[model samples]
Target chain A: MREVAAAERRRRTARLLVHGALAIASAATLFPLVWMLAAAFTPNDLILARPFRLWPEQATLANFAAASEAYPIWRWLWNSLLAAAAVTAGKLALSLPAAYAFARGRHRWRDAAFGFVIVTMAFPTVMVIVPTYLAVVRLGLVDTLPALIVPSIPYIGFYVFFFRQAMKALPPEMFEAASLDGAGFLRQFVDIALPNVAHVVPALAAFAFLGAWNIFLWGQLTLASVENKTLAVGVALFSDIEGAQSSWGPLMAVNSLAILPVLVVFLVARRSIERAFANR
Target chain B: MRGAHGGSLQTAGLVAPAFFAVAVFLYLPIAASGLLAVLDYHPATRAFSYAGLANIEAVWRDPAFRVAAWNTLVYCLVLVPAQVVVPLLLALGLREIAGSRLAPVYYACLFAPTLVSFSVAGAVWLPLLNPINGVLNEMLIAIGLPPSRWHTDARAALWVVCVVTFWKTFGLNLVLWYAALMTIPREQIEAARIDGAGFFRRVRDIDIPLASPTAFFILVTTVFTTLDDIVGIIDVLTGGGPFERTTNLPYLLWQKGLVFFQFGQASVVALVTIAIVALLTFVQFRFVERRVTYA
Candidate 1:
């Protein structure tokens, strides 16, 4: 009985130690972001002053006003929303049907086609980006929203693979029952396959939205005009123009704006995202 | 049989749009990169002339290419293992607190930075890393330690870049690791403990093997993202500067092709980068795939 109590005490100690360490690590990991948040609301002079303030002396809206005045912050935010939404929709539209085909439809060359799509997952966008940019230039699509959205959609290899796996796990009998009800292929896909895999949509949507919204290099190259830039690209531009000066306040403010929508999206979808990744 | 035939046709129709777009944007560009590497295009004449092995030879001899190649290797070597091991450790710790209220807080905090774009991450770090009015330096001064340039120092630039990149992106791997860890049945570990297997032995003999599939997935994705995502951070933070200390092959490709308009040389760099990724992937599948337990 004494030995068991000793072991229990040891286990509790270990648990406390582990939890304590994790808490410290979490604080350190979040410090940069927390600092950015604090700086965004702090006055610029206090930010650049020595013995740096961890929290703002007085929170102010001046930084946001200043950031918007300096750049088309609102316009960039709109562009980011448009580009991310369009790209996410395009990916879902194309990949859902294709994944349905791969998972349910009978075809001789289905695996071959799936292989063809999945192989591109290995091809980094940077590898093909040069030629893609040149193609955009040739088509007179540079600096346009399509240039950002259209090419972004085709990198759906991971999405298709994921959705196909999700769809394949559905019982074959479910689809057979739908077919017995005289449902056509398109009808079965739209009504049965898609609805069954709807749990995955939020997860894939979060991934696609984050991927598209966080587009920096492509947006930088494609969207040349300041007015056309996404929030991701605009933040970079704000930093560059502001340079290594005392404008950390406005820069952090812009940075906050860039991350706000995505953070909200991620937090809202966190549970489904957790489930989706856990299963896959 | 006739209905099955019609289903196949419909399948083809369903797959065609995605296939076509991927071909044009992804596969076609990949193929065109190869073609453009060998053929010289003149803007003046709007004509292409075969350049033979000139582009390949040029990139091979270029000093910038050599540095970029080395830096790329350094990145992969450092990032791939760190991303794999660190996250697995965190995931194990997280599993211990699975049912507790603190679990969500840990997940939310760790995963927060990963959701932020690379550009914003870079922007956030810029002020903190600034040598002169930066918070980092101010802290150092307060502690009676000499302040140092973070990304500004040539020797430290690559490491700084790596640290920031790791900070920004490691959460994805952490999530993947956590997910993989959850799949391990409790009975197996309890059984092992009953069988007198120590902690290290249990982890080595069971947990590691069970998690190998996610480990392999994490390894491949980490390398790819390290190549693609670092460019934005590099652009915003150092611009691959402090004397080109942080320029990897992808950044080199961007610089050569887009910045310098040397499309031929950039194509060569691009092909080399692709070859490196392909080779690493092949190696992983050949060697690591065998050990990955499907469940």
Candidate 2:
């Protein structure tokens, strides 16, 4: 009886320790983001105040107001949305047919071509930026949305490879049966393969949207005009060019605003995002 | 057979638009980069001449390129182990927790930063790490230590970049590690436990070996991705400042090509970066393939 009681106590102690450690780690992981949000609302004077408070004594919208006035936040957001949407749509439109072919079709050059696509995935985007910039400049696409959209299309190759992997896991018998019914390859892809990979669409779209939204190096280099600038470039406008001094309140406020869309998409589609990452 | 052959052709034909698009958009540019690397090309002159090995020789001799490569190597060496090991440990530690409710919450917090842009993260961390009026400095003062200039100080700047990049992506490593951990059969662990193995022993003997494949996957991918994907961090954070200590090859490539208009040098650097990544990836696949056993 005494031994049983001792064993129960040990089990309880282990459980307590596990819970404590998890709580601590989770808090540490979340502290930066939570602190960012907290500091954003804290009065500008108290933001750097010692013994950072979890909750601010006084809150103000002044930071946000300043950010809005200092930059074209709304316009940047709209441009980002439009560009991201176009990129995502173009990725799907271009990648779907390619992925279907890679998955179902047999050809002599298919493996070679697919290998080429996968190899490009490993090449750093920065390496290609110079040539791509030259191409855009030659085409007179610099400073236009087309410059952004055109470069983005290449990235869809990764998505094509991803979708093809997913499609390959589907039963081949279904495709064969569909083809037996006289449905052309395009029709079969549209009627059959499209519906089956519906789950992946949201996941791919989320990935593409985040990539487009967070795109900075390209946006900063290519888009010279403020009107063409995405939110990332727009947010970057807060830093003083000569001194590198940034307005603390407006900078944090705009930074928070910049991340809000992606955060929303992530929260709404958390499950899909989880699946997308988990699959690989 | 004829019908099947025709169908295959039709499928290939259907896929042609995407194939052509990817080739024209992605592969062609990359190929062009290779050709440009060997040529004396200038955007201003709109002229190109064969430079033979000149660009390659210049890049090989460049001090900045050497520093960037060294920094990238150091970053990868420090980051890859921490990213793979810490997350695996955390995930393993979480396995003993009783309630399932806390798992999702733990994962949510861990995964949150992965979704945020590195640029925004950099912007957010900048104020937090500011020297005088920054919170980090204030905390140091509270602890009775001197204030440290994080981004401005050359010695500390690369580490600051490292920390931010790690924070942004560690959650992803955590998630991947967690999923891989879940796949380790309970029986294998329990059997080890039954055989008088302690927790550490079980982890060392059973878990680590089982998780090696996943670790290898994460390691190679992270190394290549970090070498390539850290453009956002560099662009936003220090702008490769404080004497360009934080500039990786990717950032250097951008700076030389676009900012300095040194196309020949940039192309050489780009080609070198690609070659290094390709070599590393090939080596990793060869080494890992022999050890990775998928059931």
The model with the greatest DockQ is: 1
Give candidate 2's fnat, 2 decimals. 0.52
CA lDDT of A270 in candidate 2? Answer: 67
Per-residue lDDT of candidate 1, residues B23-80 (tens digit): 8889898899999899776755657789999999989999888989999999999988
| Candidate 1 chain A minimal-lDDT segment of 10 residues | A48-57
TM-score for each model: 0.97, 0.92
lDDT of all predictions, in order shown?
A: 0.87, 0.77
* CAPRI grade of model 1: medium
**lDDT, model 2, position B23:** 80
lDDT, candidate 2, equals 0.77
TM-score of predicted model 1? 0.97
Candidate 1 residue pairs in clash (backbone atoms < 3 Å): none
